[model samples]
Target: MAAAGVSLGATVLCLLAWAGLAAADRVYIHPFHLLVYSKSSCEQLEKSSAETPKALTFTPVPIQAKTSPVDEEALREQLALATEKLQEDDRMRAAKVGMMLNFLGFHMYRMLSESCSTASGTVLSPTTLFGTLASLYLGALDPTASRLQAFLGVPGEDQGCTSRLDGHKVLSALHTIQGLLVAQGGAGGQSTLLLSTVLGLFTAPGLRLKQPFVRGLAPFAPVTLPRSLDLSTDPDLAAEKINRFMQAVTGWKMDRPVSGVSPDSTLLFNTYVHFQGKLKGFSLLPGLQDFWVDNATSVSVPMISGTGTFQHWSDAQNNLSLTRVPLSKNACLLLVQPHGASDLQQVEALTFQHNFLTWLKNLSPRAIRLTMPQLTLRASYDLQDLLAQAKLPTLLGAEANLGKISEDNLRVGKVLNSILLELKADEGEQPTESAPQPDGPLEVTLSRPFLFAIYEQDSTALHFLGRVANPLSTV
Candidate 1:
């Protein structure tokens, strides 16, 4: 009897080990890696799956929206033709990436600036906005993923699995941009910069998000707080809760309370970015200076003055002049002002042209006196609203599979991105008395509504885009 019992126990142990081995053969790829497409990555994915790749598919019901269906086929073909001229090898290079990012930056800047022109100034972090969209791409399935790829301007004519947009590459490039800022902000750098970014994911109470999806946000933000809140309970209370939570975490207050949360919503994505840049040789003057909000209106705002040899360009044809001011070894600030006869709207519209930003490369150095208002600007807007205005309200709507975000169907509510920008001018070491005086260096004064962008010097990667309509207005 003892021998028979031992034999049965041994048989059970053998069966258990075999079952474990079979389970181990079925590898689970994180949703973050699903969008990573490469020949070797594809091979690895195939080897990990015990069954066909289709077996690993996760398709959820699309979050419903009240809008007309978009022509996906037409959009895809248009994008293909637009990028057909570029050589395949140049598609994902640094230059192309810069242009692609600028393209998206100009689009978002236009939407935000135009909407806020009547009310207040507009400021946006293009890198942060791009990362927000890329995070969603990680949770999207094809058709939805393809649409995002087209919007992202990922180089490639084919949108198949083998040639899918590489989320990893996009995130990596964004990370590089952030790293440049950090290096430029280090101690003893040419300028003093403080940049803080945080992403908040608020979900319905008791809702569970995919662990992999939450972890995938690491590349985009150092801190991503995912919390459960009953958003529908009381809109006012919900806003307070989020505001208090963000304040406690980052110590920065939102200029306005978050709104547009829906009772039926399942998730609200919000990102807060705070940026402060102080020029080394620029110093704030004591009294307020006149900043023309328009032809007839003017406001007294704190002003900063500096004298330096800066790169300048006057585009008489476009009725705008640009000045490139160094912020650090790897970053510079582009200040663009329209000619007196031209309005901000006209100059802004011209930015949509393909070669508009290339003007940065054509600037010539000239010694000059520069004065501008000290800027403390804040801008807050929802991405969904922008999409609605852009006539693609159904882009993230129902029929879009977001299975990777959550097993339970998710109805995304409002995706908000906010910015708080503070630009100060500091007095550096006093100029030497023996230095040669320029022969009437041109004087450039930004006393009116103007556009500004912070860019990585080498790559020309746009970090921030904004329009200062009123130096006194921050919203």
Candidate 2:
């Protein structure tokens, strides 16, 4: 009986030991516990263990215990504080950007103006005068009526001071500048700088002929004319003289006006030529002729056949056909023409076809196309070329003083630089809290580059002028 009792106790002890070992293995030798276990059996034990209940699948039962609710007012206050901080940061960033843009623009304008002035002086040099003259003559031969009228005297009894040769050249320069602004795709400030530069050139004495000579005499001195020659009777001589003058001024063969209405019919229609000569002391030559030509044209054409008028437009399809004819081998000219049509679409199409439009679609106001027979043409020119041609004489002789030109250039440059700096500074300055933001995913900061242009709402007459953030430095 004693031996049997001892055997039973030993068996119970062995069973308890086995159970304890199993429990320990389950608790401490789990897959996640292998690192803490002894290397001898931990890895094998972990591999044999069952996977634990995933936390994602373990939904807790609701507890009866009560908890405090979040404070809505306090949460709102915290959010407001965070928003304010974000806004402050944005404001600082904006201000800095604005200042930098303004500075850059101003300096760029100054540089362009200075360079233009310097170029004007150099182009007017005696060595360069002949080339300049050649360019102007070639430019006059362009098919566009507005350009032709600008270079040559307007034909009519109403011809006044504006019809004078000098006045025509000035107008041509202005038109040229307008075209250039359109072609170059820049802010109106560039055009303004160009305008100012040309005006300065006009005032410079180097451009004006010092000795007054007969207009038609120098070229045709060998050919004698009858004292009382009738213009109608001497059509040949008149034509020859006109041809010589044109050749001397511009180096291209002159095409006689086609016997139909002038191709510049739109430009000349109901147009009044206004003349304002120099204002006393301001005159380059004391009675130097100043002419202002203004006109309005209206046309009604079939919708399918596009018809309208615009100062400038672009043509993507006919890019190769578009060409830049020099106003002078050395000068600049301004040219303007009126475009008209029954509606916007037709006019735009025509302008596009002719390559008169600027690349900037947003800034383009309108397009003009005229229907004259089978031909369609767009009016365009280089402002600098026009000015160079008009101011060609100024580049010649001792009168082409570098110091005066440099001073003028610097003054213009400073003004442009200041403007740019102010604009950039404004951009850099933080926006006030009171300033409202636009409600859109695409926010347009007023600080971004912008362009402005003027248009006569009733007509295709577009005068583009404005500031841009960063004008590329290609020019």
Candidate 3:
């Protein structure tokens, strides 16, 4: 009887061991990885059961929630202690700021790399995505802490030494993380939890106290202008005016001529202007058109054209009207010649009013010190010699550069111009007649800070630039 009992016991033990091994094989440690593993394991189990007569009991292991217990009272005391310590230890504050910035940079790269796909449609690798998200998470979490260091006005080495860890920064960071997850297509309860936690952290006054005073002050600050402008508009008159301004400011000419027949002696041109002063404000006024031209048939209608001190001759084409202005050395004047011979005077008057109003709208009454550090103008480029150099993306195919331009490119141009104007306005300066010579590419550099604003004339919607200096500080 004893021998028989031992045999049975051994058989039972063996079965238990086998079951344990199977469970180990099927187990997934990480919750995220479980979705992929669970399906495969269940399929395998079903196949095995079909082949074998034995019953295979499969029980899924409960996912262990990984969380640290938080005693609210204890955390408050610890945080208070930390704040006191920070007041004395400059090294600690500096270390924290460095950690936060490193984290931020990582996430910024991650989000941008993941969200933006190349024109060819290649997605970012998982490893890359992970790294990017991690970086952004860290950065968003500590902006206030970092900004506080900036505010204390501490000099190097000792700077940020006494900085406080802003709870607000943590909340902001969490919010940003939730946004990034949504952007990456994550949905469901986990995302909701993250958002809720962030909101709760922000609502706590003690946590809010941890944020920098400057960060707190952000909400009460006045709206500023943008660093760029988008002046590209349809209706030949608007485009023409913008082009003339660019020519007058930059001393450059359009690579191609405007489409359609010029009115008797009238010429069509477009130019991108550069100004040194900061932007203030901008407004647009709608008025009745003096006359209408068949825009659908017009090929390249000149926006702005005039003879300047640095004149360059453009090769003539029958279907196009061309104008070249040189703005390199001296202040240049540009005369915009409108199409339609019968209403030539009306066109001229409209063009002049449009230019004047645009200029006036951009100059705001509120004064703020603003400067533009850089500016760039992008347009369709025509390669005079294809064999001379490998064609880059900017070069339009054999199709005429200006003639083949699409609505998207025009929209992009307008956005860019509007942003520029806004940047100038934010700096509390008005655009003046300072046509800085282009040293390298078609770009300009401002001596002071600036603001940016963008407007879509078609939709009449204003798009503000989200930046550290702008109204939307958290983004």
Candidate 4:
């Protein structure tokens, strides 16, 4: 219930901002203004009496490594205090941060989907990516800091320290969002939703890391494990080591070893996220169904179907239809599919429009029979590559100052953000074999390439955005 109220006002504010403000409130407030902080204020907050965040060390563990013991009560107390600081203006600011991350992650999703359209579809965790950038911002200095700030959608950066933003506030807001999701999801038990994240910092041997910088990452992930590895000499071995370490610690098995690590790089920031959603009224169909990857390509895959009243919209003008299926009381799934002969590319282009989020707001409830694949979508990408694609090659390049993270002339390696999404029928629900009535629900089947998004109903936050071109591919 607490999670439901976290930034609940933000959803209303966003709607008012976009849907046109009332006559009494004609002064339009830009969302970014909510997050702006004066330099003096940021400095004062940092010097406050809050306990210093614990510094994590890069100590290597064995192949079958076990997670270090954590004092659950102590960690909870610390998090509760940190979150308590975010109850007032911090809530709206966190909501704005979530919005900013959604925009950035949307663009990244587009770029990735384009590059991998033929081979496989793509998935991105906006929250995880935001945490990665926020982590980097923790160590950035001068122009690098300014650039990262701009990338984060904070305005008025050109002005001076008076307009500087507090990295702690942003990271704290991010932590609040993560906490809200876990709390809301767990309220329904494992039968509804289960979400987890792990932050892995793979550093070069003997690279001295700053205490404050390492300590600052505490709130952004549940498990922040920094380890030393011989990444440069044998990249394959390092990848295998990371996979083994994660499996040993979290019991999460990766489909393949991570690739694309630069041998010259020093620190690799890796975040792994897992999310599973079980539909209430859905059940697996008897056998495989024909899924149209494109107009010409098709494959047989497992399908699930259910009949229920769902929030839906058909944008005939844009040649696409939107469907919102409930995953839990706090989260839902948005499915967008192009009509007629239109393809996934056409649907992707629609995201660039200013009124994209409005589509979600405009959905109307409709009784329909929805049939879609039983998805186990997996995606991996290096943040460095995404930066290059955005034409910001030097944001983390050699010239950047990262003194807060390390003194060595460090080459930032692959900032990996791996995501896995699983959606299946709730085992408690039984499949119905009754014949359709004369006035049956409208049938809407996803047999072609389409786009999907996981959204938080309470905060109106976009957690994950992705496209599914083929049901069989899990890249």
Tell me the whole-model lDDT of each prediction, alpha carbons only.
0.67, 0.22, 0.23, 0.71
**Model 4 C-alpha lDDT versus the unseen true structure:** 0.71
Per-residue error for 245 in candidate 2, Å, reads 33
Root-mean-square deviation of each candidate, in angstroms?
16.7, 40.7, 28.8, 6.9
Report the C-alpha lDDT of model 3 over 156-216, residue by residue, as the tens digit: 1222212222333332332222222212111221111010110000010111111232233
> How do these models rank on lDDT, best leading?
4, 1, 3, 2
Model 1 C-alpha lDDT per residue in residues 255-336, reported as the tens digit of each score: 8758757877878889887777777688898988888887788899999888877888998888888888877656788898
lDDT of 4 by residue, 1-475 (tens): 1221232335434433643333347674434444556556757756763655544434344334457543433443343345434565666666667777776666666667667654367788888898889889888887788777767656443565556656776887787776555443333343266666778877888776776787788778767887777888988778787787776766665675477567887778888887878887798999799998767889999999888778889887888889888776457888987785454576677753255687877898777789999999888888888777666777888788887787766778778888878989885743234344578877889988887888775456678887787888877
Query: Against the hidden reference, what TM-scores do the models get?
Result: 0.79, 0.18, 0.17, 0.82
Query: Can you write out model 2's per-residue Cα lDDT over 343-455, one digit (the tens) per residue?
Result: 22232233322223243232322222211111111111222333343332222212322221222211000000000100111112121122232541211111112222222
Span of ten consecutive residues with least summed lDDT in model 4:
1-10
Please tell me which model should have the higher lDDT, number 3 or number 4: 4
Candidate 2: regions farther than 4 A off = 1-442, 445-472
Question: Where is model 1 poorest over a 10-residue stretch in terms of lDDT?
Answer: 58-67
Shift in Å, residue 402, candidate 4: 1.6
Per-prediction tally of clashes: 2, 68, 63, 0
TM-score, model 3 to reference: 0.17
Ranking by TM-score: 4, 1, 2, 3
